[model samples]
Target: MTEATNDTTSPVRPLRDALTFLLIVSATFGLQLLTLVTGIIMARLLGVEGRGVIALVLAVSVFAAQLSFGGCLPPAITKLLAERGANARDGLGHVFRRRGWLLLLPCLVAGGLMLVLLDDGAAGQRFEIAVIAVVVTLQTLFFSIIGGAMQGEGRLVRMAWVALTPQGLFTIALAVVAALDWGWSATDVLLAYIATGVLSVLVAMASLLPAERGDDVGAERRVPEASLWSEARGNYVSGVRPLDGLGLERILVGGLLGTTALGLFATGLAVSNLCRLVSNAVSVVVLPRVAAHQGDPAQQRAVVRRWFTISLVLVGGIVAVLELLVEPVIRLAFGEEFVGAVSVARWLIVADGLLALRRVLIAALQGQGRGGVASWVELALLPVLVVGIALSALRESLDGVGMSLAAVGLLSCLALGRAVFRAPSARHRGRATSCTQQRRW
Candidate 1:
């Protein structure tokens, strides 16, 4: 029999794929730009030291969110949804319910952690930081899960717009606060941040309801919860590897070097990380499609080659431009107070470019249910990151921290490259050539 018929066969598939990629890239850029603007607004309004407080708060909240189901489930959900014979509605609903209860653990843990860490703030201010961290964690979880579902369902165009919800809402709130010239403190800005999260969750949830109901009518058979969790556990590690660097680095910077240093480092990270737009979008678009076509090794190889090549070219251009323009851009956009971020931003830009390729390689492996391979690779690299950051701190050099991060990215790309691109063994080739029966994921 001929292979299954799908959108891949359409005559306009190239154009359509190009448009979808653009949409995803645009949305990702919007998200990054908004985050940069948010930091700028805080810096301009609150000064460097005040921005430091907000930085510490966000570092804690995001770290906690990464630890929870929000950060862990997206890749897993996307892969599950992309299974050709799987029930998107039933599978999504099943996994959502199974994992929703655990959200509380992150909320409570993050809040308590933040409360204990805030030694300098007034008791009321500390309480607010803790409470807001809890709220942000939950909201971020909803955003991520819904976004992942949308991607896995192959609604890439719609997913792009939905991805902008939280940041869009926050940008608007920040604008209002700034325009009104309210004497807003760090707490006020954070209050505004949490308010947007609430609105974003409502909007994202409401937007998905119609699709969920429509999916109800044509739902296929459900995958067992046990199987889903088995996949999720491997992907959870794969997903959190990036976050481990992100969450812990920020906490360590704040703890060892102080919040002012964190503010500079965080802002640099936000600016430099805009380079990830291409790779981030590529990973999101590539993973589900690869998963859907998992039985075909040739198709998998071709898809990875095309998308990963595109990711590299685009990211290379972005890193070069950012490297040239970042110093000026930081001064012009974020002001002189954040000029210290320039050194940090420059090195981070290189690191981000390396990370761009690493992510695509990881996505390819994850789509094949071989996420454990990449997870082990990252686990081995984790200590290198810790020691590097510690050395950076000891030297009191942000540039040192940036170099350490870049080293990790370079090593990860080299390691994962070997894994993803190596020639298939005789056994693997035989399995690929002989397999004709449809296997359940």
Candidate 2:
């Protein structure tokens, strides 16, 4: 029997990993449910207008964070770990210590600029929104770095706890505070988010401390500096490439359709975000598996295909359900003023399904170390998105506008799917060629 078969038959390792994956998924889903309840409470307590304001601020914060972080966290961490699993334990500490300051510099400058440029009135009573954004960005960077360390070591259970607890607790706390009328203004809400972010970082840091004391048992050899730079750049490019077009498209929509229309659009996006809980759960499991098997072509392809199929089926089913119950869901979550949001949500159910497919395809690319190609694909689609959003916003009817925007999502899915299918088959071919070359050598 093969060595791998013998190892598999040993029983302990697979069981442990499977149990860990199950635990992480269960805890994550629980947290997601709590978060959903929190959102519902916030909508009920704040009313449509208030919730709209909160949504606007959040959108801006998330946009700023993406730009500041360069959207590099996931692939960077996963790649680094996969490439230098053991050495990563040592090198990452140095990388974080030195790079932390450099990363924070851009975020600080951007946050300051945003504070100066955005109308203070838009921030409303959440005047401290800018500060909260800064804090959240810093915390996110630190958390990502630490989480990367845990992932690199394959300690996913620890990583999940470090990554999710603060978010779960913060959502629960905010809902409770808001419900009780316990000094919960918009600013207070922002503060809670910032606080949660800080706590997450702290927990992640704590998780990493033990690794410092333990031996680097599985650390891979250090990658070359040039290779490391190339990988990092490629990953950053790939991750943010989609944002270039997508961000511009949103901007165009807001400018052409006005804030009220944007607000309505935002609600649809938020409803769609609920669907992501499933995608995230799957990703949390799939990503590290892909990374660990980077050398195995057949396994990699099989995993990618399986994940894509499963994600599409699951997301599609959820969207269908949401489509059927759109009106009642809106009434229960956001009250009557947001009745329009129901139709928007129904349309977005389709959009989010498309988005989930795109996400899974991109994850596969990242796993295969083709982040640069993925980035290019996103860049290619930007203009189409921008133009689509602009045209949609110009429509006279609000419902027409929503439909137009949703169409852009459908278009994106088609374009992205084509690109993913067409990606270089070189990785698979290389495996065969390498075996022949090794025999000759």
Candidate 3:
């Protein structure tokens, strides 16, 4: 399992790390490109109204996913496995039995809510959509458990494959659907996601389970006993898990606007989010390394500084290019009605850039066991987003939604800055001061 970890003090290691990072980026780009292409195809197939219903339904699906995986399982498991290195299966089994099992009830509940929304709120094709939502949520829950195991073992290439399989499968399914002239309703399109979920879980399980039978450098070593899911409690929802809150916001949009409006907004979101997809690829590779190096504060800072610079330069350059092409691209992809999407989209690209940087920052913080800072950051941002997006969508201007999201990104930047840039000793002194005041009182 040994590879180019971040713990090395070798001078030439940076070059190797850079090369490896590029590979990760390249692989990640392929996955995201597949997703973008799938979106474009789906948009063309379904037109605006179909696309909106698909977007809203998928939003609900994403929320079920979040609730099912729980917040802390992936990172917590990954961190624990990275540290122990002795018994991957024991750590993994404990995690699944504890927090992973807990996700089933929430998945069922989210699925039930999705059924209510589809049957009563969405109407038409309700049975099919509801069934897919429940089944897919259950599929994702198991897939996530295996995914956490892959990450925990630092089998990153394997992990990337698990991540990419669903997109690849869905892309292929779309092609077949198009070839067959399947009527591209929202329900018709969602079958691609559901089918892919089942297939990918099988692929991920094949990767995650093999490490149990194999021996590695850390396999025979002994360590102190601990619960697999010990870290699954507090920050699980906020910092530990992917933001379901974002999905809920989209649902809010669907409720406020009709399907067509939601589709337009979703298109703008998807376009702007392309850069975020790339940045997230960088993070997927970076997190385990960060977690491995968390014991040394000096190494942590160095690691943070290096990646922060890389993110700014890389994401900044991509943002610049995307900004220039935003208009022509939107017009070409979805036609004249969405030309206004370009204006809204440019701001969202900026927001995505900021959010991407925050990902790097949060990965570092979570690696260092300061996950509470990230949890607090999310807690603070949610209200700002909910209110801002609510007012803007109600006002019938996507420009408002774009600007509000940008504002949230900016706020996240500042919060991460406080956590990242503040000296540890200074933070300690501040905490000490607060503690003194509390004791005196």
Candidate 4:
């Protein structure tokens, strides 16, 4: 199949496909903008210390949410859901029925661990942070699963809504508080954030029900439950384990260095994340497209190479511009209080650019059923990250922490690139050889 191949599960034309990609990019951009605004409001209202608390809570929640997946169910299931005529409802239900309860335990453990280990002399607020972490975990899981379903069905617009709604709602709440000059504390901001998460989940869930009303009429004919889990487990092996560590970085920074440093790092990281706007959208859109060409090794490589180039060129340019403007942007938009974030943001921008490349490569590898290659590379480098951060913190240098992240990102990008561009599998090569002989015959 070519890049524009139309099937029941993917777009039919270049124009429609382009529109789908643009919609996702626009939504992602909007979500990031809202997030930046929320950060600005939080920094202005809560100052550095309060913002640090918020950062820690969010980091813990995200870490726990992704951890509970054991590193593969989301992508694996989403890929299965993309099979033409697969019953989306059955696919979603089967996994939830088997593994749904597994999600809560990680959240509880992460929250409890954070509460026990990190006490910044604010026992009351610390308890609140623990509670918020659990709530945020549930919110993130629901959003991700529902969004994955949307993605699986090629419902790109609905998927984008799932991505945007929570941030949008939370940003509006913060705006109201800012305009009215309400005496909202850090705890109150978290409460509002969780509330929006709940609402967004409800909205996303409702969207699926109506759209899939008859999608499961012949559920037995769809992909089998056993097969789905089997592939999910395969994906699980590919490990993407780096995320487990990345998620824990905030908790580590908070416990080892204190919230003030975390706040500075979080602010800088947030600003640098804007550089990922195009790459993020590209990563999301590339998965199924690459998967669609899985039967043809050459086609799969072409797809991966084409999108990889696009993501690198576009994201590279954005990183360049942001590097020049990040300091002023942080100073003016986030206030002079966050000036400490400038160096953090600069390092993170370089890391984010490298990360943009890594994401596309990882997605392509996953699509090609070679996720194990990427997974092992990431798993090996996981230590480099943990040790780097610890040594950096021992010296009391947040810039060193950021540099460590950039270093890992660069290494992962290069390693994954080599893996992605390596010779096709033996099976594919043999198939090609057979085809050539037959044609000669």
Candidate 5:
């Protein structure tokens, strides 16, 4: 969202909520640091071309999962879970029973395609990549559900453990793989990722287990989340969830400008995504909290404003640092072959900051289970993204892609800004959401 009004008389935020945000931010730091290290190692090992190849593969994997599967289930479940109370168990069970099998196809498709792409490399490589991709994708889904459970339940510290454990495992896996002298090809790296995913899933499951309730009481988040938003939760099959991959920019980039450009662009992506760690940490912790207090539009706007303020404050410093150090960072992290990413990286960090801000507002809307007027405005710009990114890709200009991103980011801020500040009463969204839920049933 845009800059919030400086309302000195805004109510004081709860110390507990502030603390939760800090803990998640701390965990996000650890997670992203681990990821940064992993990316650097992988980039060094894979070289520019191979790194780009993996990026294209990533784009494909994301496309297959988000587009085909309709990416809104987990967060919807999260909001619903908080509001479900006595129905939590039944609601969750119904979700998995009905949709669990649907999850397998997308993961399989992603892994199968990656396997096919690697057919000419090595038989073992193909097998390993396919297996790891499928496993990782599966783990991703499980991780989302478990993490969302924590989010809705407002177990921020526990959620932090779940989020951070995988990264720790990843670092360990990389060390083991390197010690074992498995050359860091895409297959080898992905294999390590799979191992981390398995371990992380175990950690998440453990954290969520009933036995841990005693220990978590110290964090003031021990209660069950079923009662958080009992009255205002959305239908299970709500509107299209804010799945980042649903955007077709990267796939189109790979298709039009070729994989080499994809590689260069992915380099920038690696750097730019670092900015999301902050904003997502905010969104992840804030969504359930806001959703828990859904009815008061004034309180909601105040919460959005707080988040918007945090976004500007954090992003300004992050972008400045990244801009100043872009070249040296790229050179040291991914080497000279990816020097082209420096310019793109600078632009992307800005785009990503705005995107992250937009994400917070989207999470705010989702917390209420129904989007406001601005959500549709953002959706209507989906065509703008397609056309902009496509035209940019066609011109073989990474700069164009960055510019397109900035334009989209600006529009998203305006749209989501309007949403948070000018949201309609719950009545206005009732009919549309009911119709969709009815159709889904």
Candidate 6:
């Protein structure tokens, strides 16, 4: 009698995927919590005005870091790995190993330019800020590249661990130092960040090295040098433009409203953007899958739809809660002096909910190789952001400015949401016809 063939399907549940998602979400949430705690401690230690300065510096660093990286590497690596699978590891390594330095060159130049452009009352503090900016930019770029590569290789669990561990340790260390009555200067925090950044990079590189070793998959198809360069260029260009828009908006706000006001606005925005962590965690998982299924329109659409629905429902629920409890949250997390931030934080929640939904749509576009379109969309919206920020900055009162900015948030959300919904869908008959026509070429 013929023995029944064993079902060789791996018995392991999609626990790996679930764990990967959880790890990133946990890491993001932990980082936010640590920062919140650190911020609280720093406020108590440094008083309101000093805390405001720290927040300002952090805002500048965050804007610089995001603009410097251009949000390209993560999606680029994810797409390449998804399309090429395990056989693409060496090529992926080659891209990262070679272009990594080139990616950093811009950050150094931009950071220096920003520092030079700013009016510095004291040379020592200016120099310190410059150092912090450089360190922060480097830290951001390294973490993004390493994290992206790991996610592309489908080892997101390791990537998430690498991403979180250093930040977690640094946060804990900072809290200890603050509790012990160590001076809470900008230099001290910058040093802590640098130390953590170095540690995280080391861990991520070590974790990814093995996966970067190409497996014996019986001779894979060679990716052309030109094609790889073209892909990288496309990703870089597409990614940088939106980030530029965002950066420009922040810079204008900082310049027009003074650092203190910028500090308040930025803090509120950061807290609100924390909700996007949920969508981001999901995107890391969804990006690779979407890329893998790009050739199959039906499958791609199904995946995108599923993730989008889940994101909207989750983010919407969280925003509702945040809107209700924003006052208590702000007072508890950032101290009573920041009680004025409650309204701004609520507005940000509304904006972030819209942004979260837009992210899912953008991810789908990126996965489908519509980077150019995504880039154009961002460029188009730059004017809207600029106008909103300018009008808000012109206000004399903080509450008035906050309300005007909230109006901006509402407008931006509506515009972004419209763009997302109007984006080309797989189910569109016209798109299907276009796909068929393109296939003939």
TM-score of each: 0.88, 0.79, 0.85, 0.89, 0.79, 0.79
Best by TM-score: 4
Q: Note the residue pairs that clash in candidate 6.
A: none
lDDT of 3 by residue, 131-182 (tens): 7776666776676656666766767666765678888999999988887887
Off by over 4 Å in 2: 1-28, 87-89, 109-113, 116-127, 209-229, 241-263, 284-303, 367-369, 396-408, 415-428, 431-441
For lDDT, candidate 2 versus 6, the one ahead is 6
Clash pairs for candidate 5: 52-263
lDDT of 4 by residue, 1-441 (tens): 212235625445556667777887888889888898999999999998889888888877777766666355666665666654343565567557776887788778768966975555447677767877887887787777777666666576777767788899999999999999998988899999988888888888877733245655566535576776786677664533563334666777887888889889889977888656777678666766775555577787898888888887888888899999999999998899899989978998998888778888887887666777888888788889889989989999899988988899999989999988886678855654564344221
Q: What does candidate 6's lDDT look like per residue over 1-441, in tens digits?
A: 000011213354245446666877987777767666666666566654445545545545555555555466565665555445543346455555556677667556545744653443324576667667766767777777667666666665566566667767777777888779887775676677678778877877777645433355333433444665565666765565452323554466556765556556655765677667887787765655565454466676777778778887888898988787778877777777777767777777776776666566666666665656666666666566666667667763444444544454455445544543444665653554555355331
By lDDT, highest first, what's the ranking? 4, 1, 3, 5, 6, 2
Q: Where in model 6 is the C-alpha error above 4 Å?
A: 1-23, 47-65, 68-70, 81-104, 116-124, 211-226, 241-249, 288-302, 396-441
User: By the TM-score metric, which is better: model 1 or model 2?
Assistant: 1
Provide C-alpha RMSD values for all models, in order: 3.5, 5.1, 5.6, 4.3, 7.0, 5.9
Model 1: how far residue 97 lies from native, Å? 5.2
Best by lDDT: 4
Model 1 bad stretches (over 4 Å): 1-7, 84-99, 119-124, 209-223, 243-246, 288-302, 428-441
> Candidate 4 regions off by >4 Å?
1-5, 8-12, 94-99, 211-216, 219-225, 237-246, 428-441
Q: Counting only residues 3 or more apart in sequence or on different chains, how many pairs clash (N, Cα, C under 3 Å) in candidate 1?
A: 0
Residue-level lDDT tens digits of model 1 in 144-248: 778776666666667778778878888888888889988898888888888888887777666653433454445354556776677667667677765243477
Off by over 4 Å in 5: 1-13, 68-70, 84-99, 112-132, 176-182, 211-247, 285-296, 367-374, 423-441
